[model samples]
Target: MSIQIGDTIPEVTLKHIHDGVRVIDTPTVFSGKNVVMFAVPGAFTPTCSEHHLPGFVARFDDFRSRGVDVVCIAVNDPFVLQAWGESVGVPPGLQMLADGNADFVRALGLEMDASAYGMGTRARRFALYAEDGVVRHLFVEAPGEFKVSSADNVLAHLD
Candidate 1:
């Protein structure tokens, strides 16, 4: 089953590419924080690169002022995620996380099989507002759609 509001986000490990590959624990990072996490189909895809991730980067301040940490997740490797972050100039408070093994996305029941597109396993586009470790709101976009998971939509709910 997909994660729902009021559920505690499961503990999963994510990678952050920095001075080297760093392993980040999901529960440790999200616990005790008001978090806004959005997932994309893949790094550098047209829709994800052009609109989805950029929306969050552009609205970084909007989410910060409200005391929320915004993050982006993709099924790509950490190296690719790091390159994408640098290429896009991801601002502070907007994190770029790599679910390289698709473990976390699969746990949420949000995994997408994109082998037809030669993308292998990927994450469906989605976003969530979580308080501490419990999900307060969830938005999973329909396949090929990009409405609910956009930054504007997530920020509007925070207002």
Candidate 2:
């Protein structure tokens, strides 16, 4: 079964670019934090690049003021995630996490097969709000749909 509200985020190592490519486990990232993590199928794809990421970029402060840390994850390398964040002007402090091997998504049961599109294993578009590593809310988009997982939608529900 997929992870749900009240479930603890699974432990897995994920990569991100900071001073260098750093590998951090999920427990370390989510522990003691009010976190909003949103995942995309892949980086640089149209909807992901144009809409999904930008919405979070635009609302980064809204989340921060509420004492929440915002994260964006994709099944791409740390290098690509870094470059994409720079290209889109992602403000500092918004984490760009690389679920490079799809381990994290599979653990959450959110992995989707995009092989038909030649993208191989990918994450479904979804977002979750967690407090101290325990999920409080989850918003998963329907196939080919983008609505509930948007930054605005998540914040609305959070409030």
Candidate 3:
């Protein structure tokens, strides 16, 4: 089963490009913060590049105003994530995280095999809200769909 409301976020190392591929842990990112994290199967894929990430980038301030930290995770390398973020104009506060090994997604039980597309294991498109590391809301999209996990949708559900 995937992570659910009221479950604590799993501890796993994730990467980002900040002065060169910095390492961060889930606990350090989610603890003591109201976080809104969205995951994409892979970076630079059409929907993720054009819609999913851009939606969050456009609404970064909205989330910040509501005291929520926005993060974008993809099962790609830190370099790809950094380039994608720059290409899409990701704001400073909205993190672009790299889950290169799918460890984080596996821990959440949200890993999906995309071997048919030659992508191997990747995260299902999902967005979750957490406060102090405990999940409050989770929006997981059906395969080949994009709706519930959109930034606007997630923001609407935020308190």
Candidate 4:
């Protein structure tokens, strides 16, 4: 079954780009913290490039003002996310993590098959509000659609 409210954030090792590839320990990342995490199908895609990640970047401090950590994840490698972050000018502290192998996305039951597009498995567009590792809210979009998974929508759940 998919993750739900009250479910602990799953444990998975993800990657982040700093000077180089860095390990992101999922469990420790969420431990003792309130976190807002969003995922995209891939990095550098049109909608995600124009809307999703930028929304989070714009609202990064707002989420932090409310005492939450903001994170973005995609199926692309850490290198790709690194370039995307720099291109978008994502402010420091909003982590952009790589679920390159789809392990964490699949663990959340949020993986999608993009093999038809020659993209292999990717993460669906989704967002979640979590505290101390337990999910408080989740917004998962339908395939190829953008609705409740946007930063504005996820921020609404914070209220």
TM-score against truth, every candidate:
0.98, 0.99, 0.98, 0.97
What are the runs in model 3 whose C-alpha is more than 4 Å off?
Answer: none
lDDT by residue for model 4 over 1-159, one digit each (tens)?
778888988899999977888997898789999999999998889999999999999988889999999999999999999999999999989899999999999999989999999999999899999999999999999888998999999998789
Clashes of each: 0, 0, 0, 0
* lDDT minimum window of 10 residues, candidate 3: 88-97
Report lDDT per candidate.
Answer: 0.92, 0.96, 0.95, 0.92
Q: What global local distance difference test value does model 2 have?
A: 0.96
lDDT winner: 2
The sequence of per-residue lDDT tens digits that candidate 3 reaches over residues 57-157 is 88899999999999999899999999999999888888999999999999999999999999999999999999999999999999999999999999999
Q: Which stretches of candidate 2 lie over 4 Å from their true place?
A: none
Number of clashes in model 3? 0
Instruction: Give the lowest summed-lDDT range of ten residues in model 2.
Output: 20-29
Clashing pairs in model 2? none
